[model samples]
Target: MHYLLPARLDLQAHLSAWPPTEVPQFHPDALVRLLHLVTEVPAHNRKLAKQIRQQGGYVPLSAQLLQSIERHYNHYLTYAVRSGLLETDGRWWPTTAQVAGKCRGYRFTAAYCTPHPDASSDEVARQPRLQLVHLTDPKMQAKARRQGRRPTLLSPAERRDLRLREQPHAPLLEWLAPNRTPLRLDQAAALAYLAERFDMLPPVVAPRPKWPEWRPKWLKALDRDYYASPVEQYNQRLHSIVRLANRQLQPSIDTTVGRLHTTLTNMSSELRPFVYADGYGPLVSIDLVNSQPYLANLLWNPAFYTKSSSVKSTINFQNFRQSEIYKGRNVKGIIKEIPDIMLVNISQLTHREDIRLFSSFTGSGQFYELLLNAFRQRDVTLTTRKEVKELVFQVLFTRNGYYSPYKALFCLLFPTVDHIFRLLKQQDHTLLPRLLQALEAYLFLHVISRRVARTWPQVPLFTVHDSLVVPQEYAGQVEQIVREELRQATGIEPTLKHEQWSQAVRHDLLPPTSVASSIELNKKNR
Candidate 1:
């Protein structure tokens, strides 16, 4: 270790000569405003964005703060969700803060901005440039420290100082896809076909209100008549108690025990008063700390909400009809059905179909039909068995590395794409059973033909779900086969490929007929 030791005085002098580092633009008010937005008892993303937007006068917001705002809002929205601050059907919206300003932390007040009202050509000629003054107010710095936010934007010099401070960001890199696609499949066509063949999957079930109840005086409610409620928490908890009691009351010839909602009347004292959601239109709910259901936020439902085009939250409102609870106590005892075997099977299948279609496919129709349609237009010409194996390999372990993320080649080769992709995270292992199932099914009823099931000597083409990549000249032949096979498998008549898919499909195939009906968007699936 040969180092120069006598240079301390010179080093100190040199350091003293360096310019001061620039501070990021921070204001005391920003932190205060943000705290008000976020800690709003039950912080919400929409509410936060809205609040920011409401402060019409410019606030010094920055990109960093905006990002934090969205992040924290999401955090609190999740909180409100778990706390039952919202109803079972409640949704989140942005607070006013998110949209009002371009930068999240940078604010432009008349004082900070140039004196010129407008910066036009003449203003530019006047050399009217405004200089930014770094803030040094101790109070503002203290506020920034409390909120765990950076006091100002980091200039190059200040950023270097952060390095000196020993905090650093994670290294970022772009992991390449290696080979994405030279040819493409029509996911839209596939989804549409699937939706037609199989119905749209059922969404999550939520409890609704029962029929109207006689509004008793507020004092009378507290007094508790014999028929009055004793609070209970959660739908399932109430259900279990009611069901057990119903078993006790079972269609018997007792003196006087027709026990309708008997268990509901016996809830814990702390929970009974909040049981009435009938008067409230729609409320958002959160689950427990363990993700179990608990009531959350309640929003006033507008008569107009039911008509929105995109049925995100609107579906909750529309679902109120089938729900007996939504009808309230006045309509409770008219009639009910126990649900026989046929209905139960039908319901289970319908729900499963919904989940598969919704989760497996993105952007529309259904899952299975899309597969049939896409295969129809594809040219599956196979000279030998090698092509099939290659195709299968491409589908399964499509990525070059062991730890690579799931890729699109997944569409073609692997059958259990979902299972295989997900299982990568686990230490447990399994052979490609589901993939075997999918391939066996795909291979069983299918063959290369001019048209589907046409049984040509040469295997001309194959389909993987809804994607079909075939020669332009073979479009007509592929189209005919797709419709025939689709009908054969699903029992639904097939529509034109163009009608079923995105209009912007790079037509390697010839154009076909168009049908007037189908939602215009029902676009390409994933």
Candidate 2:
């Protein structure tokens, strides 16, 4: 909620000259709020202090953000520029205009600005050096606007926004974790570790021109976004891990799918290696292989559709319409009207040979490798497990009409499975992902997490999606429980991978090893 302002700006004196009649949004408090929108980094994140040193003293605001801020008060930005708070490139785009490249926006006038291609070094240095001032007063925040309209009268977006902003965090479900005790962690020790790592990190630098040819190892596994710059990503990761280690933010679970989200989940996977839990050094995670595809494979089992079957209630599609995923999806009425048609389709597809093959591939964790080999046989360009894994998700979860060469290849390979997938999402594309996630959460959170907690009361438990992260000493025992429970429930012998949190590289990239292998390695070393 805090904002950034120029250190030299005399805010009280400046606001005293502006009469309420002449300027409304420029009132001292509102002006700071306006700056909040322009400042992309959070004040609580001290990474900004380092970012300022690395990326020159000024931070650039994108055109889209500037436009969003302008929507609130059109004249505020102009006032800031006139008052020597901000500097712009003198280019403006209409809301409807589609700029060919990234749209540039205003930056806070900094004491030492990065030299631009168009400006001389001396000119950039001579530009009045300004220091960023952190504004921390909660009184400066905009008061919540109360819409006098009834809940039924509000627009869907407004209601959703209101709910998200106002909703209080609820307790974890007993079925998921009977132990309602707070998660134990040595916060001071974790913070000390994180601070030391932060201090050791080199200054953040923009990627070189040949960045795509070769980049830092940490950059490899990151989800690619063309819109975000590398420098931005690095700074954000630094900020997130710092917040998490210090426990400034807490862990919470989503009620709809029973998925737990915490500070650990929010940070980059590459940074997770350095993090410890409950003072347990060098943790490891037991991850279900191809979790989504494996979950989807369960739907092919006829037992999954039977109410008497133990698995049915856990991932019952009958309850999906009531879930939050379909709140505004407009599929409830269609599902209600055609429940029989859905059952018929499921019954017919359950015993197909293609489905059996699909189930086999996913269950054994050979699905990605199978696809990669197939692509290679067909002389297609896909060469790695990661490439095929991405393609599998696109085929399974993307809209029915979305066309890609990989999707076409997948449909041709398993026409029956593809048809069943399309049929499941005919009413709503979201239904398929929701159903899969529900099953995953049930297996990991409810069955695996609950059992692990009861079996090893002293071992700290953490679930991140389809993985169970625990102390290295207990990884083998927990892995056995996870494997046994999943086999008993689904009748599939799932492939489980062990990832040591101490390793800089992902377990998949490293030589394949089990918790058993890790234990043996530790024994040999000892």
Candidate 3:
């Protein structure tokens, strides 16, 4: 186990980059890498490192490598101890047997699952090394197929056998949920519906309040309030952070504002000509065009009417209103309904506890109810970043996002409060709707073929605000469906951000090329 690493590393290149005279006696980065390698490589020694060395096995460990390993031993060994993977003996020692055992197990498991039968039950039972307790029925290889690795017992159904889809263990994913729900609050109805949540919904990140120290005005105003020792001096530190956060918010707003406008334009017109009217007949005056009748022709005249939403979809002037056909999914549910308003709450916490409950008017149980109702009522989709990933974003945002000078509203605010306020103000105003759409697409992908649905399917035409500019292929029917779903999802009529957006493309914000081509959708795109 004390084997020296077979060093295939470029000793000359390292020397040239950092001449030994200018460099420390040992290379810190190299030492660090060696430490990490020795720490994670079970049953590892310098010789084992040599085995993993990419060089054609020609080189032996060098003084520099040995020096680095020696210098960084403590750091590496400490990490190894915490990882439960190595032991410290003035050098990080990998569990050589553990590494080999796991790999051998995996190999045997893999070999067993291969098409060719390697052994019978009687033969496997005789091999003491092959533990067959969890996987007795050799022929029923569902687990093996699902895992697609080890030959286990009865094959599970395809739906239940998504064994390969699990994400690796990450500490942040460990959010505390009393049951299946994330931390939330509840009040006995009789105690008071007119309590904390009544004033405003509890913050999504708020922990229970410590009301005694530098109490919030609202809490003090309560005729009857409870006492808890709050950390008030920390308010100064939080306020300072908020000021810094404001400085950072302006640039993001500027960046996102441009994207919002760009997407809007693409939805309205610029991308239109590329996708639509590839060979559709030339447009003359609609009044004049109405005189002709065929598969496509306008019958009613007095056109260019903005008053009628139906006219835009028509194959000809008279048939616009009749064009829409397909209904959007999820815009309505069978038994429940809810409004479109997005609710947001953010509270700064003094204690980062394991049980971090975000108080709620209705407990998290109500979240299920709300979701069921929403699911049952409409066919709209929603989007969210992975919880751990989102929390990381939150931390970043808290540090440098959404707190700024132009955002004078958040002055003297806590980072958490400002962070929430800005998320609702900027993102909820525009991105929330889009995020909802992303959520729907994600669910569709999960329920359908995760990879296939994610990469290929879902005809997302294009989007502007909550409205999407679908292809003219669905040309006549797309608008009607969007309108229908918009009504059901947001309780508001949705309009196509653009029409004939493809035909007219100009960034100078010039007037429409001609009166005939000046569609409304084209107008918003510019």
Q: Backbone collision count in every prediction?
A: 85, 3, 40
- Candidate with the greatest lDDT versus the true structure: 2
Looking at model 1, residue 322 earns an lDDT score of 33
Ranking by TM-score: 2, 3, 1
Indicate which candidate wins on TM-score.
2
Native-structure RMSD, model 1: 30.2
**Which clashing pairs does model 2 show?**
110-130, 111-129, 111-130
List TM-score per model, in order: 0.17, 0.57, 0.20
Q: Name the 10 consecutive residues with the lowest summed lDDT in model 3.
A: 286-295
Question: Backbone clash tally for model 2?
Answer: 3
| Cα RMSD for predicted model 2 | 11.5
Candidate 1 runs further than 4 Å off = 1-349, 352-441, 444-471, 483-526
Better of 2 and 3 by lDDT: 2
Q: List candidate 3 segments past 4 Å from native.
A: 1-272, 277-402, 409-477, 501-526
Note each model's CA RMSD in angstroms: 30.2, 11.5, 26.8
Clash number for candidate 1? 85
